[model samples]
Target: MAYKALYRTYRPKDFNEVAGQEHITKTFRNALKSGKIAHAYLFSGPRGTGKTSIAKIIAKAVNCLKAPTDNPCNNCDVCRGIDDNTISDVIEIDAASNNSVDQVREIRDKVKYLPGVTKYKVYIIDEVHMLSQGAFNALLKTLEEPPKHVIFILATTEPHKIPATIHSRCQRFDFRGISIPEMTKRLDKIIDEEKIQIDSEAIKVIAESAEGGMRDAISLLDQVVSYSEEAVSIEDVHAIKGTVSNEKILVIAKSIAENDTVKSISLLDELIMDGKEPQRLVDNMIAFYRNMLMFKNVNTDDFEQLIYKNEEFQKLALNLSNNLVFYYIEVLNKALHDMRFTTNAKLYMELAIIKMIDKIEKQEIVFEDTLNDLRSEISSLRSEIKTINTQKPLENVVKNKEDVPESKVDTFSKKIINDSETEEPVVNEHLIKAKEVIVSTLYSKDDIEEEVPNTVEVENKILSSDLTEDNNVKSEEKDIFNTSLQEEKKVDNIVKYKTFDIRFVEDVLNNGDRELKIDMIKKWYDLDRFATVDDKPYTKMITEGRIVAANSKLIIIEYESAAVCNRLMKKDFKEKMKSLINKFYNSNLDYLALPKSVWEEKSQEFIKKWRNGDKDIKLTPIKNSELIEIEEIDDEIEDMTPDSVKEAINIFGSDNVKVKRGEN
Candidate 1:
């Protein structure tokens, strides 16, 4: 005889012989004995759980030499012939291969004929859900009203794919996966009957590796027997399956509990070197941790009931908290899922172990201790600031009294008089330096003139000449004055006629309408105007700041200096700004504040873009034309004037400026 595989050689020939499906087998036997045979039958369940075997057994029982028998006697010629696939009356079809409409139509053509040898003709279709829609429709009519002599048995692992019409027309039996214990009992029987030398532990391992499939368990047993010359041991099973031993898994778990990342990673590497699958290693680790968690939580009496009842597990559970166990399980489960798609499975497994170690270390550092340290640092900072505040005014008063030049006395007196209504006087450092320079120049003017005799002689000659040509000199002076006046008027006209290009205005309006933009700007300005620090308004910090541009969710404000921009960038200030916008507008908006120089540069870029006629332009006509007239006179003056004049403007307002030529 040729060699036959274990699963095929030990195939069930009778309903009673099938393992771990007593619910279905018992019902079938009763149905057979009662002779309540249906024209069509459906058997559905997980793979290798006896759906096909039971289907074959039902065929045999129905066409037995002795009619309507619950158990087919394998001794009978009819049963033997059907079992050997030599019977013409019994047909076994693999629906996966012959799942087409034409094939079903062939079956429909044959159902009308009577049995050739047996009492009844039986057709067993395995994997019936593989049938095409057309094939299913073709079979529907035959299945609903089959001949009295024809019996159809449809078997599938996935019955949900079968149409509801077919399901309703047949007698359905659902089979379940064999339990571990049931599978083990059957393996023990098979081992004894086949005279196989395998220990109980080896049998248990094979049973678990099969995942409740008896055929798989028996096949694994056969492989182990073939691999081992003598008695099959647990080591043989583990080697055949490429699974890590419980002892190795326990060691890994212990290393993880001790937070020894190096040892855990080394053990994992050794297992992979020994040909243990990376995914299997992760699965074992998850199971090991799950067992430990169970041991930690379950009653002591139930410890033996667990699959991993060992001392190492108990010791590890003692060291682990519930939270750590949960985190470990979560990491391993995620790694297991990731292993399927990852090309470098070993690296992923190693990373998951490292993460577990990191989590454990983090849990050891209490949050309260960190918070207390931070509070202490903040308190020390406050004390230092308070000391500095107490001494700053006195130092300032002494410095002011000592540094005041005689020439600056009148200017300081005027400032004091002008600022009487202010709560606190703000001293300008740059102004004091300017006043000192002016006094030094006044004291050295005569010496400078003595040193530059040629320049003085030239001026004297020009003055004498101008005295003689009085009319010409007067007309020249008038021309110079008029030129200055015209320049001033031009500056005023430029300020009054300031306008933004249409493209730039369109970009702003693209974000939102003009009314909405103005409203947002007003709300933001109010927020800044009312913001205070220590009962003093923050408005002082941004004295010359104003919103330069507005869009739906973006508002650009220009500040006088980078110092104010930096202040606004602080986290506390930003949070306050966001809070006010969200509170009043009921919307979140992004704000940007730039120094005057940066704003001018950006505005120039916008104008350049407008000039280029970029295709991205999408313009909305402004309802209020005046809104496009940006009040950018200050920016224009700053850009057009010389650096010295700009600096003077910075020290004093543009409105308080005068220009005069001195007499020789």
Candidate 2:
């Protein structure tokens, strides 16, 4: 006897032994128990999912000496012979190598013969999609109407390639990939029986790396056991698979979050040098950050679902914001995509690391700048408080009673107290009370004095100064108002544009008139002929865009350059182009402009939605009023009657159009 691979040594012997396929197994058991087996069966799904194993099991169960039993009695001579492949009744064919009309004809001829040992003959063809067209034709009638004692089982990973006529004749059983938990349990059974010492996490790692395939998982476990000196570990699995360990991934992520570019690149170089793949490293990093984002958003105690479940990783998750985690995932995902096209994935990974660090540093700088601004504001507020506290009191100004009128001083003090009581309540109660105290102290009854005589000159000086200040303020305000008015008029001339509404684009794509679009596209080439020197640049802008969609009322254009698209979206440019189209094509149509890349993306989405028949996504017409800006020219045009329309146009340099008196 020779040593065998773990997957082969532990192949499922019966329906009960198969993992994660209870639906198919249970159905087959019932069919076998009732003796209602189909003559031909088709099994399809991903590789390593037990399609072939289940086919063999069905053959054994149906051919068992105890004829009507669901489970095979392995002790029977017939079952024993079939299991060991000594029996001529069960035949397994690899269609990859034996895919020819002659080979299929031989099977078709042989299927008519009775089983040598068992009651029925079973012909199992694996990878049946590899069979040629001629071979399928030859096998069609035989597979459709095989002998009463014959059973034909076909299995393929790609079911789509199988002919529909063949598919219609057989009972199809789709085998799904085994889940991680199920694979883990099966591997544990193998490990226990073989008495292989291994860490539980190592088994988990192997299961995850297998990617929903039990055979691959078992094979990985075997390789790890062979490579290890003693107990297998998670590091062993990562090393074998060229994947980064959770700890290393955590360190790299922390380095990125800390903006330690040098350390991150150093670790990346070390990993790549140690035979870890750059793409795999990027994938693991992305997974790490994705797990972090999940941990940040979801509240669960199950650490098994996450790649990194340590306390330090949790702390990192808390420290990193959800937005930053999202950004990290985005960068790494882009790197993963870019790495597939290039040979030098190391450069892309380094660039991605640098980008992440740059983002972190920029965010930190912005935070520091915000902090400095807040500090400056607090300092200014404190300085204002100090200035208010040091101001001279009113009593000091009124110490010379003859220099000021006593009745006037009493009136000023009374006004201050009255205003404080009637004014909006101050948020700070202490400030309000402080003003009251100062007013009461200044207007005390004990400090009263007689009114001074002949204060006419002082009042005249005060009145003259006040009048001069008022006149200066009024003159300044009038100048500012005129300047602002002129600026506003100039700004209004440059018509402002708004971002294109995506809904309008969807409507145009779904309901556009193809003939109208073609007409506009043909007319678009002749616009250069009408271009004068002044309007040539604008005409060129319109001509460069491609008309993507159009109807009687609207036309959509796409420009390769975003800047050109934005310029064409301007109200003035749009209006000028619309007028040109109307004049030349005799159609009044509004224009919508989008960048080429944007149109491609939107068109793809629209096509997908259409294919899915998404009733929830319905298109509605965009009113021309919503798309167009009706701007009024506020700049005054010279008033003219119909008689002087030519003179007015001449004076305005022949660029202005003559308007009727009432229209103006």
Candidate 3:
């Protein structure tokens, strides 16, 4: 006799044999006995949760040699034939492969016939939601009003796709995923029966790796059994799955906490050398950090109730500071997000780990930032990298300065002034030699200029050049200037300012347009601040960045860690940040990849503000459809001339203005 896989050999034969879905099982078993069955039964649930198995159980119980037992007797001729697919009455179809109106019409044609050996004919359609609209429409009426001899059992992982017309006709029985404990217990039984020597930690890993899918767990169990016939351990399973070990994850976390980039990166390399997948490393480490965090703060009365089953890790969580653990978890989570779109998973993970190390080290001497802060900082660091990447070096300084103004202090005018009398730029000893171009360009023309003795005369000539523009030119400029001034005067006196509230954390990460976490943070904090040109707001931080842990009232503006960064900004910053963030949800925000408890330590400021009815107003949640993008703010502030300031005050009000009030 040939060997059968554990999942196949131990497949549930009766409704009672199926695990973790008693609701659906009990409903179906009673339906079989009561003779109140619907013509079409829609079974929906997550994968590996037993929708298909229950369908088979119903098929056998109804067509059993004996008229009515909730449980089928496997030895009976009808049961054995159907179980082996030898019975013509029980037809199990894979709708995924045969999903067409034509295929459904064939079924519609066949329902008129009677059962051959069994009492009733049954059609089991697996992945029924995969069917096209036409296919579903074809089977609608018969599904609602099929003959007494025919039964249709439709199963799918996603029920939302099934047409409402088709869904209304069927009796819906939803199958739920088996819980971790129930899955673990079932796996333990298989291990005992198969005589496979494995430890408890190893069993737990298989269950978690299955992600609530029983079929997946059993299948993995079968594979693990084949990997090593010797005494099996959790470490062996880790090696097989390319998963990182708890010890390695701890070392990396400690390095991050210590701010040791070199050591953290070295450990990352070692894991890669061990054939570990960067994706898996990031995933396992995230779980490890999450569990450690839960252990530190929450009372998970049964520590075993949480995911990881390693005692060493549980013990390690006890010794670590609450802040450090969350920081590393946040770092690894960013790494995992990067892994999804990147083909070079190892490269991205390594880069993410390195970024985290840098942030941790940067914040080492810093204070107050806890584990949550560390996570936020890691995100900022990634944003900074993107900013550096996108900046362009200037090439032609002489050409760029062709548009310079002429005056005592370089003022713009109606005419282009070539007056060269800008008081030599008041160069200081600390400053390097002035060139033709300095601030924006790589080179400057100031280095080649000849000195003049009568500077006041030069200034007068330049002013004359600007003021003496042709009458036609001056007239046009005067009209335009007055209109702008009028608009500014109207804007500066307004009282109310707009603010936005992020209803939930999920909205915070999803920008409708582009994947931009960092830029969103910077813009939210202050409209005056520009995201680093490389990729400030979104790419570097949230898309695949790290958050930092810092100490102080100042959020120490960085590229990543928008969550905390936004919180640290002024109340106005929070509103502005929320508004900017509203654009980031679709890959128009998708690429933009990018929380916490303070044991509720309240501030008196919030109370005072609340009394004034400031805090009582509900926050305006973002709309689902406004577009977002990883874009540079195109405001005129960067080129903030005197006129720009006057306009800003008019539009935003005096309260929104932050000028360097000079003391003359």
Candidate 4:
């Protein structure tokens, strides 16, 4: 009459009243009706999953005033007394506290006694796994050969801890966690009977938060009812659980789609500061994206089926690419998994959001590249048309042995080289010969020496010093050679990193030893030892990559993502990995990390050439003192027309000049 929690007040008195556990209930009911009750029974499952409640019901059903009944009629005096805990025949024990051998021995000694007010004396032991080994041994004999009038019900969350000797003697029943729909139905019934006004969505939130435990669901429902002034809303559930609303999750998704890193992170910080759980936030975001993806693929007008149905959500589903949504789910799922091992959950979520933003930026870059490709194609077409117009008159002039200007010959030669088609048209032999002569004349060694005197001086000094062993060189020239060597040394001393290098892959393949790769792979299991420290991020990154090729002096690792490859390519990461591997494998071996896509392209090329009987493969080793870092650059050829050629083309005029090839 004072105050009882929903779980205690609504405890099922009959076997039929329990939800989501019809299998165990039906079995016990049929057994009780047929008088086939076991002398000792063991029930094991998760907490708050009706293990103890069902144990009590079994005791009452067996001892009810009216025998031969499948369930206890609470109207009877015997059932009422058992329910009120005033009966002497039923004994309930918390084995967690009374887990000594003496306690179990006392139970064994009392099994011969008759029931005082019921048909059978029942002993209910909770958390039976907590009993000591000696206690289990003491109870084993009694359980194996219990008196006809005695009944024992043992309940435990962890059944593995119970000894096999005891387990073999009892009837074991494993209870499963309540399903979501079943839990929601039970919670709905409680809310209806209690006359509590709450939104249907709020009940679902509570059920989900309970995670398949009936008692937990009821407890959360009771708490929410008490906290709300009137009808409980979904917001109230979110507030109680420290999770964000569906609308907030939508906003975060939009921010990510827009590549707004600052906004996404700011919103995340606010939620974390407001006592919202980072793990729950990531989960909700993942669900949001998942629903959006479903909406795109599934033909459903009922917005109720999805978690979010607002206009903003619809727009996002319409606007966001399917690929981006998939990536979002992947990143959030990884963050959710990683958050369990770290106390700083917020950091991981923030990093995940940043990664999504970067993905969006990369997508935009791809789109821009596609547009540039279209423009390049159009320009190439126009140049082809101009070539057709100019080549006609040039062919006629060549047939007549007309004296063409040197500029005109250069223009014609450039067009012939720039043509995309493989076949060359008929042209005057003299014009081709003159073009070759002019190239030799323009780029003579004397001209190069005048342009870059330091380079020529260094080359001359190096040859003279090498031939004479420094005896024929002047003191001034010797100083120049030393300066050159010092400069080269400086360049070689700078350390660098690259996102991907074909040379690295090639070097490993040329010297790859399958036996060495297998040996190193067997030793990769030792990597787990480095995982305990926080400073070894590269170790974790290394685990993400696979050892595709290996040799005594070099190794090639392939990763699924370029982002990971880029991270592993940092100067500090390289040094740490090199030192770690050297110490770990007891070898001074260099390693390369390449994205799977790049590796596939390059390795396939190598295989094709190797299959064609090309055995001249070579290794391009990275200097230990310097590994040059190259930024990702567009590989398309750049314009490199010589000044003289450009001047000649201008004199010939824009219309007369058709297509002209740029020097490499």
Candidate 5:
């Protein structure tokens, strides 16, 4: 007599009526037909996938008046009573609410009794994974060897939470999400039966929004129908869901692809003014780009799979390269992620759009290409060095300095011979050219001033003196020159340690020793007082930060603010901190500074690598003495039952490890 919601009113009555999941339904029918029903059944999958519905159907089929029938006779009194909840033989339990050892023990105690006025007794426990550990233990024995007349059906959205022991005893059926097409077809039938007027586009909008859940689709349809007294339109669905229209999304994507920053920002402002959420807009843009990418790659004629038609997708995809499209997707995805923690979502979205346009414009000057060029130059230099080693000795030319006229030698070589009186050596032409290239390519003017010195004069002095002297002096010059060259190499290595970014963090996390890193962090924290300059405690300024990762040579520290980072970036402060760190470790180590936000991003990236089973990103085990001591204390406290001991362990990590004893 009362009006019911569409999902409830159209609940599937049998296996044939259930939408999707025919694999599970067909198996149930076959098992029922052959009279080989399983004692315990576990249905697990995403929500609204018919796990509970299939459980109810199986119950009716087994308890139907017609013995061992695949289809339940709904017209029969036995089926009618079960459907009305009047039959005592069938019981439905919500394990989420009654998830306790006592409740499970009650079920185990009652499972031995035979069904009354029915062929079999069925117990359906929904959200069974919510049951406590003790409750699962209680259910385990009964589930393993249930009475012949009793049938247990356990259903959950997350099967991974269920213990393997329970899983081993049950026949598990995984229900999959309903497809969009399947959902659309079902909605069409429902509209036709209900005599409701709705546009096909509106049905599609609801179906896509449902995200592969029939119940959700039906509920959305019902809500939209209530909102529009007449035929429902796509606009109504969009307004109800607070989503931007596909046409607006297309326009935004087109603006980005065309590098129209002004147009993109203006349209974004309009959307924000019109109550469109910034995060939602970002998500829609990401989806639009993803669909364009699919159209570019997948040669499918099915327009249903795409959000836009083929022609529209073609026009957009043609204007964008696959690499650019991927880059846009990554930018939008990052914006979407940042929107969650950011207070000004609209500002972030606007900046994201600007960045996309900037990236597209600068796509010609890719960083990867720059790195490749650097690599090529380095290889060329290596080859040049090898060539120099095989060439005729310059010593012979210098040995005949007296035979050649003054004008014969070049001014550059004459200057080297004249400058030999000074302690500085004249660096050879090859080494000078190499130094120029390194400075030009890798360092700025200020860095070059600090890096390469007047070593050329020093080299020239050694060569000139050695060519005009005895064997002992020549040998001494050779050793002195070799020492100077080694020092230059060390300076080059130091230049390579500039500053770290996300890539460096990733590298350290993947390849750096974990225990050594933890040890370094602990030592840095302990030696904080010594890291000070000009009476300002650099350590205190950096104490708010943390060392997230480290290697033998480099330690990555993350600070909460730019001020702290800037303070630590001071030359004197950095030197003092580095000195302190070296003192503790007894080895030269460098500290890399990063913002907290950047650290969080890199940490998430590293975690994803770990999850994907990346061999390079191995998670380092925590084996520091401090942690070991805490663990030992925990083991000792396990046997203590006093409330004081429990509270102490909970607060101080151990019952016996106290900051202070009682005064008495």
Candidate 6:
């Protein structure tokens, strides 16, 4: 071959050659040594973690002529043939392309026979998730109960996509991505063997960028080394990879922290203009801030710090507040990730820049507010100090005076225990001193230690009084309800009518509501309130969007016309809206109040009201009236005590009747 990719050239040939998958490697070795191998095995994890390579190793180990060890002696013809795919016994199947029921049936038929020349027939299926439902079903029984001499090794990146029925039958081993340090060590050894000149920084950059994929890092290193005979520098690596420079990232963060709007915008434009994806640009900025936060609070002495390899980047992190950095990191991380799914990407990018400007603007918080915040922090600190100072029992001993005579207090009797046991004096000196401190600190010398009355009974009395007040309120409501019911009965006898109120309006607000509704309907009908002179409403407070939130005191409605809003404040539209709402929701008792203008935008009008003279008239339109004919109404009535009694029975039905069998 003219040339081979470094990753393929250095493909792991033995268990020892594989990097950073000890969990997978150890299991394979044990399986080989124990000879208790399953007929079908599944290896699943992130891509390039050696799942495919391990499957190949298994194929070779089982078919090796001279050995049963985990490591295959590749010098033998069997191992050589397996590597070359010339061995009749071993078959490597790319499941992704051949995942069909027919293909699976063919394989199932073949696994029934013994190996041609080798000890066992091995079948390796890669990316097995692509197998159809029917294909997996076909493979299920054969895979579960394969011939003793046949081995099935299925590998997939997303094991979750594979049918659970087939997955349950196979011996599953999850391969993991290689750790960075492990990948780095292996890359360094290969660089040495290839005699490639590269700096440690370049190697580190490639390793971290690989994101735990060893083969990826190797491939990256090979690409970087192809064009350079000199040792690679961070700058060179950054140029080739089109990665954000750590210094530039720091400058952007600093500008954001300093509230330098001009610089922040300039930097963003430069990045976007220079081919950085707006989303990726946001991502890098987020990572920059996250690193600053990690450095700000954590003891990095114990951590393997990877992001800011440059000393200058570390200094920038040092200058930023950890809390502020953390806040920015969290917001931008979410924003950057969300930006991918957004339709207006430029708008989202503008939003991210605006956020950075906001952070910078907030850096200089008010001193008084910060002082109040520090009080909480100080309390937390004192609590920590208290916890650390005395883990011993009995922390509180005395508070008043410095000394006490134990002889005068001999009536008190107790013995204290300590983890440190020692002989006590006839009277403990410490207790005497502590007692003296308590007397002076807590009480006056002449103050009597009387048997004071407890306040529990007094509290109970107040509580009972409050409860009685609640009872009175409830009773008042009951009385009102009863009175209302009696009034309702009278109203029922005297008239057929509807009851509603229109209120909670100052005269000014009522005037505003009247004007607002007229203006709204004008817009709804596209008519001019003053005159039909324009396409738009005169009061541009035309309906735009719903009122997102409202309350008893105020209702804030959205409008297309900012000018209308400005005029409303000058003319008190809020008061108007409030009165209108009260009138519609609780109708003005006189029925003179107008219905509220600010109904939920999506809700159809439930009630409509119009002002009649000085009194408002509310109309609840009957959509479909079902009027009863007089004869039909009479037929439903029963025989009664007279025309009046019969009418009452007919009106109230059997419910108002106390009639015995023949009383009527």
Model 6: per-residue lDDT, tens digit, 547-616?
3222234333444443444444432443453344344344331112122232221112211112122223
lDDT of each: 0.70, 0.75, 0.62, 0.75, 0.73, 0.61
Error of 4 at 372 (Å): 25
* lDDT-superior candidate, 1 or 2: 2
Estimate the TM-score of every prediction. Answer: 0.56, 0.58, 0.56, 0.55, 0.57, 0.58
The digit string of per-residue lDDT tens for model 2 on 1-664 reads 9989999989998887898898899999999999999999999988888999999888898889897988888788888888799998899999999999999999988887777888889999999999999999999999888999999999999999999999999999998988877888999999999999999889888887887788899899989999999999998888788888888889998898787999999999999999888998999888888778777887755524536468889899888776668778888899999999999999999999998887422443333344466577656544543343256333433343243333433344344434534443221123333434433343324322211111222322333333423546545655676687799888867745335666567667656676677677777888878766877777887888888777777787888776776667766777787777787788777887877777666665665565475633554332232234334456678864565777777788666775645554
Residue pairs clashing in model 1 are none
Rank by lDDT (best first) = 2, 4, 5, 1, 3, 6
- How many backbone overlaps does candidate 1 show? 0
Give stretches of model 5 more than 4 Å off. Answer: 299-303, 360-664
Which scores higher on TM-score, 3 or 6?
6
Where in model 3 is the C-alpha error above 4 Å?
296-312, 315-327, 340-343, 359-664
TM-score of 4: 0.55
* Window of ten residues with lowest summed lDDT in model 4: 420-429
Cα misplacement distance, residue 344 of candidate 3 (Å)? 4.0
Clash count per candidate:
0, 0, 59, 0, 12, 15
Better of 1 and 6 by lDDT: 1
For this target, which candidate reaches the highest lDDT against the unseen true structure? 2
Residue by residue across 1-664, what tens digits does model 4's lDDT show? 6999999999988887798899899999899899999999999999888999999899889888787799998889999999999998899999999999998898888889998889999999999999999999889888988889998899999999999998899999999998777888888788889999998878877876776789998988888788899899988888877777878888888888787999999998998888888998999888778778878998755423425457788888887667667877888899999999999998999898898887422443333344466577656544553454366543333333343333433355444433312322222222333444443344346634443343333323333333422343344555675687799878756644344545567667666676788788888857757444864665777977888778788888878876676667776777788888888888999888776766665665665665475555543333232333545555689878777767878899757766656699
lDDT of 4 at 306: 28
| lDDT (Cα, tens digit) per residue for candidate 3, span 1-664 | 9998888888899876788998877777787788776778889989989888888888899888775876788889888887788998989899999999999999999998998888889999999988988998899878888999999999999899888997788888877778878898898888888888988878887887788899999998888778877877888777677787666787777776565878888888887887777787788777877767776787765525433455656656665666656666666787788778878888787777776665333233222333345566546543542343245211221123454323212232212233222312112101112221222122123412321212223433444443434546545655666677788778855533222223222222111112133344444433323444543553233323232211111122233333543333334443344344334321121111112211011112222343365523333333322213223334555755588799999999989998887899
lDDT by residue (tens digit), candidate 5, 398-430:
345553223312234455555444433324433
